[model samples]
Target chain A: MANSNTQADFRTRLQDWIPKLVLSPSLAAMLVFVYGFIAFTVYLSFTGSKMLPKYDWIGFENYARLWGLSHWWTAITNLGIFAFLYITICTIIGLGLAIFLDQKIRGEGMLRPIYLYPMALSFIVTGTAWKWIMDPGIGIENTMHLWGWESFEFGWIKDRDMAIYTVVIAAVWQTSGFVMAMFLAGLRGIDNEILKAAQIDGASNWNLYRRIVIPLLRPAFLSAFVILSHLAVKSYDLIIALTGGGPGRATELPATFMYSYTFTRNSMGIGAASAVIMLMTIAAIMTPYLYAELKEKA
Target chain B: MSVATQDTAVSTGRVTRTFIYLLLILFALFYLMPLFVMVANSLKPLPEITGGNMMALPQDWTIEPWLQAWSSAQIGVEPTGLKPYFLNSVLMVVPAVAISTVLGALNGYVLTKWRFRGDSILFGLMLFSCFIPFQIVLIPMAMILGKLGLAGSIPGLVLVHVVYGVGFTTLYYRNYYAAFPTELVRAAMIDGAGFFRIFWRIMLPVSGPITVVSVIWQFTNIWNDFLFGASFGGQSQPMTVALNNLVQSSTGVKEYNVHFAGAILAALPTLLVYIVAGRYFVRGLMAGSVKG
Candidate 1:
């Protein structure tokens, strides 16, 4: 009787502790998988880790090698070019679309979905479709030539110098709809009486938008810019799908470089260094915005 | 301040209306052009699709590509079909989204209403995790997964995705709940409701829009994933990986029609969601951005 009672008491305690115990697996997962992996990457970058995880530490050598590599330099320059152009163009285009779409026009609902449909399609689909559409011999250029406009030059995707911009175009298509939706929401939230009052002062359309509407949409722009910048930095699958970071690495971004280094070349240490560098770069860009946002919310 | 003001207001409104309409029509076309091209390409034969006249209607329209895509191109097993891949993607995505959202909501609730001593530190850690790129940890993660004997399994992929997904979903829920009034929680507590009961009875009921949003976003993200599938999932891969192999093989004489059809097949779910629940998706996006 005493033994049975002790067993029952133990069972009761186990059942009571089950809920708290359940959290242990996930907590362990976060520690071992998430935190552990991050720390491992940092440590690996300091070691001469090749295809496999190495224990021997060769401190700062990988960083020095990464700094000296031409491919890394190209990637950095391409990232700068890609980020600058893509972010700037996407923000401008997105803001314009949003401002235009905010007019409470007819068929606004129908048009909104149509614009956002690109987000539905994978970048692979877009890349393949666009590649065919931009093919010099078989695409729009050829078709136009058949229609008598022989002088048209629409081969951007195939061109090394202009290939990255093709990605910019496709990305703009994918995200501008999202930006419009955000801006439209912001616009709708604005008090209608403010616009009416502005109109009463004989403010022209351009003038009112330039002064009143633009300033009011600053929050939306900031939000869109941050998201776009993030997309730009973390770009990989899209670049791979669209150009394979090629026409000889002209379209390479840090993400793709890291991927190639780790997976293809098996340079784990250099790859980790690249990842750390990219992470730092993204942190630098995002930290200020995050702080401002938190402060504003507070 | 009366008559002149009224006249000026009417004139400016008219001008603005005209300008808005013109810009809308133009921008709408710009957005729709690529999609139109893709649709038009999907309808044509390989020869015509690759031949010329990208902006023109196909000289002869056929459903051959679609048929082939559904059958041979997308079909999983040689004898069976694309149904397996579709089911596989569904299985992976549904569980992933569901688990992540539930965990995210719990995390949010715990952080917001039931603050512990180290709550801020935990929340900060979650936030920090979002900035940690996948590239940074891919090798180590792979190694860990290998050690756990889950290197190339659906559950393993789901597990990795969930770990990555939680950060974003937590952010979403935390922001959403923060924006919500706290009086409800207090009211529930006063009415003798415990934490879990209040969450289930009160918070979950009102969290419908966010739940839908989270599900939709998560579904798309997991469904369309490529890199993880390529690295971890391998031969037991999802549709996207298979689709990549299908396209990448054979350099000469591009199979444009089949490729287009494959693209369409791959995009069907997310596209369907966006088309059907587009308003909700937009609402979710706006909410997400504003909170950020």
Candidate 2:
């Protein structure tokens, strides 16, 4: 009897430890790869590291130099324009599509997939398609000329002044469908009785949506805003594939700026600083949201 | 059902309904036009694209561009085409997705069924990793890969993807298993089923939906990833990088048709996944956002 009890106790103890053991590998990986690597990058930013990561403390010198560079300013300015336009346009189109599709439309099944297939595509693929279509020599401009519109001119891909807008167009095309899906999900989850009640109260369609439905979609709006803003900030693949950072530095955002500095330009310190800034920007937006989410669950 | 029928609040007139359908169709066309252009141009010969209407169906359809993109097109000094890179991506994505999913299932199982102190904090940590701009880890990750002698290789890419992907996969499984009844897990445990046994038999058998969600999400993201493939991919560049090289190489006469074919080739796998399992794809997207 004593032997069996100890054996049972040992099995229970081992079983208890098994869960922790199983979780440790992933937790350790997150710590080392995610948190540890983040620390290393932050440390690299404070040092005089360039060309390679050197261990000499320099105390924000890279940041000061980073701030002074005209190229950096251009990247920041481009990012502001890109993020603002990208978010606003995607939201408007996405919400519009969602509202329309929610109205018991025919062929909704076929249309939703069409709207979302772009989200499945790599930004590179999207970029290549858009780049070709936007190319003046062989793309839309040429096609327009061929079809008897001799005065057509759509050279935004090659034009320095308007290249960024082309990026916005491709991005919107790729993601608006996804935003629509989120809103649709939100719309579906809404309590229908409330809508009926509001209808019985004689609210017009416009007033019903504006006063009841739209307000109820607050979570969806927050999710879209957060997701879109982060995507805009981390926008890299599309920029590289579509504009290659420009018709001459016209579309250089912070992501491209970080890569060029770190890998190509041998300014690892500056790149690290820029990367830290990017992390902080995302964290500022993400931390409180995460805290709220996790705390609510708790 | 009746409430759902009346949920639209105000029924619209025929004109408004027609207008709504028209607007939806227009937006759908807008969404699909680029894809249509790509498909159409990819089938046409070079001159048709350069000198003819892009919106027009190909007058002389040919698969030459597709063949060239798959096998003979020049990619960064190599005439090896996207075949090898596509293979590399497959190898990278498969292992990365598999390992991360398994790890995530275990982690999710533990976090939900086998509760522990500070588990929520740990989960919060894992979840936050999903949203970090990966730029911060690029330099250090490169250094780590170099140290491990895995730099620029397929394995290196796999390792990086799995490490980053665990957070997302974990989130999926956790949210899923949270809704699962603990009674089954408890009954299995009382019957002397070991950890792996219970998980394999009880948790995993019922984990199909979330698994689909996790796999589709991981496959798409890993296949479509460009920044890592470029930074760490060195010699074994993935399809996205290779496609970019094929399209962006400025030395040769630009073959727009070939470029479109290559882009389509790069897009096919994820596109296939989306078409086959788009419901789960949307579920993954929604789950990733608006966290449970």
Candidate 3:
């Protein structure tokens, strides 16, 4: 009896320990890899690391150099344009598509995939395909000429001033459908009786959508903005494949700038600084969004 | 009041409906243009392409570009095409997806059913990882990978993705498991089923929906990733990197058809996933945004 009691006590302890054991790997990994790396990057930003990691402390010099660079200025401005246009255009197209589909159209399954398929692809693939379509010699411009519209010219990929807009076009193409899906979900989730009530009240379609439908899609709109803004700030592969951040740095974003400085230009310190700035920018967008998310869960 | 006004309103409604269909078709066309161009151009030879005809069916049907993109296209000094990089992406994605999914399941089981103190704060921190730009961790991650002697390797890329991707995966599973009935778990425990036993037998058997969500989500993300693939995959770059290199290789002559083929080839897996399990794909995306 004594031996069996000791064995049962041991089993209870093991049961209690199992959850922690399963949970520890992920917790330790997050602490070390996520939080610990974040701290390490902050420290590196203050150091004079160049072409390699260095421990020599030189505080704020890298930040000063980073802010002073013209290329960094270009990246920041391009981000403003890209983020604004990407978020706004995707929202408009997505919202419009969602509303149109909400009208109970036929062949919805077929049409939904057509819009959603692009979001399934990698940006590199999107960029490469778009680059081909936007190529001056063999792309849309040439096709337009072949179609007898010789006045048409769509060479934004090769044009310095208009290159960023090309990035915007490709991004919107890839993600607007995703935004559409979100809005559609939100629209579907809405109570159908409200829409019916509006109809019975003799509200016109235009006023009905604007007053009730659009306002109720607020959560979808917020998600769309947050997701689009996040994608814009982190965009790198698309720029690399489409413009490589140029026709002379016209579409340079902080994400791309961080890469070139760290790996290509051999300036780790400034690269870290740029990364920190990008994090801060994302954090500004993310904190409240996260708060809302957690609060809702709570 | 009865006839003229009603006729006018009905005619206006018909016109508005026609306008709506036309607008939707036009938008769909715009959404599909690049993909159409890619497929159309990939099937045609260089001559048909350079003749300034993009939207037309191939006058000269050729699979040479597809073959070339798969086997002969140059990426850097190697003319060995995207095959190796495609394999590398598969290699990285499989392990990362499997590992992250399993870990997420464990984390979810613990966070919900086991519920120790401070688990929400721990999860909140993990949730924050999902929003962070990979740029912030690039430098330190590079160092850590080097210290572990996995830098620039496929495994290094896998480690990076798994560590970062676990956050999203955990969110998926946690939200899912939170809704799971605790009665079954308690019953299993009373029957002397241990943690792993209950998870493996009872919980996992019923996790089909969230598993689909988790696996498909991780697969697409790890497969489609470029920044980590570019930054860390080095000589063992993923398909996206190889595709970019193939498109921009700038050899003696530019091969537009080959670029189209390569791009389509690179996108095919995720495209197939969306096709086969599209409902689950949408569910995952919706769940990601709403729950996360």
Candidate 4:
């Protein structure tokens, strides 16, 4: 009996240690690959690591140069345009679709899947299909001309001034369905009693939504905004697939700037600098949102 | 049973309901047009596409473009088509998804059921891993890959994806396992089942739904990834990179049919998943949004 008891005690200790052993590998990998790399990126941003990484500290020279470059300015301005329009349009369209679908319209089960199919596709695929569709000579414009609308010029894709907007169109199409789904989930979570009480108070439909339901959707709205904001900043694949930065660098986003400089242009230090900036911006958005969520759960 | 339940809050007359249906139909058409156009044009000859009649059904259907895109499409100096890269993506996705999901199942089991000190912080650290942009890791990842001698290779790309993907897989499993009954684990322990034994015999059989969610999510994400594919994948790029090359490659003439075919081929797997397991996909999304 004593021998058996000792063996059981030994086995229990082994079981307790096994989970930590299983978990440590992933934890270590995340530490080294994710956080460690972030620190390395921040460090590289300050060094004169051009062409190849040289660790000699340069004291913000890369950032200074990054700021002074016209190309960088173009990328920042385009990011501004893309992020603002992408978020605003997706939010409005998503909200509208969610409300419309909430009315219990028929064929929703089918239509909802159709709306989400694009989200299933890679941005590369989205970019290509939209590129073909947006092609002026062979696409919408040409079709319009054949229908006797000869002057229906929808060549925003080729126009340097309007190419960024074309990106917005493709991105909105790619993601609005997902945003709609999020909003629909939010709408479903609304308490029916509050809605009934509002209805009983003789409130109009618009007034009921405006006063009670919409306000009640604050968490969903905030999550959507945070999600959309980060996605906008990380907008690389769509731009690459759709516009390839543009007719004349007209749609250059920070992500593209980072890639071109890092690998293509061989301006590694500057690329690292731009990457750090992108990280800071996203961190600024994600930190508080994640904190709130984790705190609530705790 | 009807999916549409009458809502007293937004109830309206027949005319308003008809208008809502019309609005929904128009939006659906708008959303599906690109897919319709791609399918239509991929079946047509070059003349029809260049002739600017895209919205019509293909008068002369052909599977040649798909074959061309799959076997003979030009990308950069090589004209090796998307087949090799498609294989590469498959190779990368299968291992990455499987490994990450398994690790996540274990990690989630430990974090949720076998609670330990500092588990939440560790979970937070792992969760934050998914948030950092891929670009932040490019400079160091290149160095790390070189040091490990896995740079610019399929294995290296898989490593990158798996390393990053563990966070999300862990998130899914942890959330699912959090809701799991720990009493079962306790009962299994009382029976003298070892840790791995309990996991294999007890936890895994019940983790089927979440495993589907994790697999689909990881498969779609790893397969669709371009940033990692473009950066770490060597001579044989992933399908997304190859598709990008096929589109951007200024080789011969711009073959719209081939481009359309390649785009559709790249999307086929995820599209298939969405078609087949859509409810699980939507449920996966709800699980994510509800928690984070």
The 10-residue segment with the lowest total lDDT in model 1 chain A: A15-24
All candidates: interface RMSD? 4.1, 1.3, 4.6, 1.7
DockQ for every prediction shown = 0.39, 0.77, 0.52, 0.69
Ranking by lDDT: 2, 4, 3, 1
Better of 2 and 3 by lDDT: 2
* Candidate with best TM-score: 2
CAPRI-wise, candidate 2 is medium
* Candidate whose DockQ is highest: 2
Off by over 4 Å in 4: A1-6, B1-9, B284-292
Q: How do all models score by TM-score?
A: 0.89, 0.97, 0.95, 0.96
Q: What is the lDDT for B97 in model 3?
A: 95
Q: For every candidate, what share of the true interface contacts is present?
A: 0.45, 0.82, 0.76, 0.71
Measured with C-alpha atoms, the lDDT of residue B134 in candidate 1 is 76
lDDT by residue (B211-231, candidate 2, tens digit) is 888899889999999999999
With candidate 3 superimposed using the best TM-score fit, by how many Å does residue B99's alpha carbon deviate from the native? Answer: 1.1
Fraction of true contacts reproduced, model 2? Answer: 0.82
> Which stretch of 10 consecutive residues in model 2 chain A shows the poorest summed lDDT?
A289-298
Candidate order by TM-score, decreasing, is 2, 4, 3, 1
Question: Cα-based RMSD of the predictions, in order?
Answer: 4.6, 1.6, 3.8, 1.9
The predicted structure with the larger lDDT, 1 or 3, is 3
lDDT of 1: 0.75
Runs in model 2 lying further than 4 Å from the true structure: B6-9, B283-292
Query: Where is the poorest 10-residue window by lDDT in model 4 chain A?
Result: A289-298
**Tens digit of per-residue lDDT, candidate 1, span A140-211:** 788789899989889888888988888887787788777776676677666667778898787887888888
